[model samples]
Target: MSPLPTDAPILPLSQTVSAQRPGDAPALVAALERCRAEDGAFAYSAGREIGTFRIEARTLNELAQRLAGVTAVAAVALETGPIAIQPCWTPGRLAEAEHRLGSADGGTGDFAVVRLRIVPRRSGEGNIFETEFAGPPEIDALNAAVARGVARASAEGVEGEGRIIDTRVVFIDGAFHPKRSTPAGFEEAAIAAMRAACRTAGLRRLEPLMEIEIMAERDHVLPVVNDLATRGGSELRRRLAQKGVAIAAELPLRAFLTYEGDLAALTQARAKIIGEPQLARWAEVRRR
Candidate 1:
């Protein structure tokens, strides 16, 4: 055997897919170990409670196949959830330079005045809800209203593009009328304020980026490369391998979703490709 070329493509694990099954810790660990031994590039952590298996793989398809194998052996079921692309506007960034303050008033006599703004937060920091409204029952109501506003804004999305994520909704300041403002009034004000803020923030939709690698016969390399180019691939790198040519690129998850079938047709089922999520980047909003 010969050592592989230094520049040969190495598929790095970029995404983690988790599946839960009813099993004991030992059984889950045993199943994962078998998979790890078979799949050279594999990593996972299994827990007893529901047997959560966090499997890291180079592509979503590969992840699914690996999970299927484990589930078959462990008698576990796979649970799937919705995958979403979120829109966001990071405050103080040049992209959001057009962001303007948004405010609104609601309730009889305009008794509840709410001012709010949306700003980006560090990934995994979750959401932070803040308010400068004053004390007790009204303040509590204001807090709940702020939460409702954020949820509504997230659900409605920016111009119906998608849900909002990785942002903070701050109730910068607001007024409450002791007699005229009701809890329902404050809730109405918050919801309206959130809508206003999202409209002015100039939010951009975000999509996950994937780091991908493809290996193809030298004769088919050109066609594969062209196909990737049309799919919006970037940061491309190619090198000669012992068996064929290896190519690597960064592509958006959306663009790569249907690539398996396309690649098969293009290369006559002679090419192999794998990809995993790398990071998220601002994406152009889809026009209806």
Candidate 2:
């Protein structure tokens, strides 16, 4: 799936869907219907299909903080409990918590660091908290806990690894202690709760595929169609006329951008093209 602008806000589904030109995107509608058949939900906003990476606690804290570094990622949300905190958090108590968690360093004692940030609701109705946790580099104690929690989140219906769907995090509760509260201990609790809640929320991965309708001269049609395939484009349907051919195809979002301009040049500006986003399957990103 394509990433959204990292600093941009995610609008609610209702509003986003409402803004779309309903009947104009039959391919998108069909794709979404297929996703529904697979028990998936639409998670589009600002003309892009949104996907989230499930970050386990074993990864470096630097990696956690660098999630936003991906240029395509519109924003990173810490799915803590019922709260979905965005990167553009307000300067308040939640921000304070996030800053504190981010500044915490590991290596001195039996400590773990969990970065937290306060976020507003997608509807702009309210606020909730989200956080990420990390433990010692050499510890295996928290691995099972993190896995279990991620599994729980997946069960709750998040578009784990890959899929065409909505994304979110859920939390229930966690335990901590002043004397013996190890970072590993808190991390286990956090991961589990977050994952379970994600399932409950029904987050699914949705790949961003472009549904393009193009009309080109009869002679140029063969060359045009061949070009599309090389860029991961798949022809879904085609229509022929006296002088031109009208075809619909699905292509990866990134490939579509470059091909759009190329199509114009290939057709000598004779091709008519219209594109809309459609959902495809989810793809899990296997981390090393």
TM-scores of the models, in the order given:
0.51, 0.33
Best by lDDT: 1
State which candidate has the highest TM-score.
1
Candidate 2 lDDT by residue in tens digits, 1-288: 112112222211121121133343443434434433553222322222332222211112322332222211322222211111111111111121211111133333333332222221232232222223333543334433433433333333333222112222222223233344464554545444443333333332333355778888888878877878777677788898665888887765556546767888888888868554443322221211
TM-score between model 1 and native: 0.51
Steric collisions counted per model: 0, 28
lDDT of 1: 0.58
What shift in Å separates residue 34 of candidate 2 from its native position after superposition?
Answer: 34
Report every candidate's CA lDDT.
Answer: 0.58, 0.39
Worst lDDT run of 10 residues, candidate 2, spans 83-92
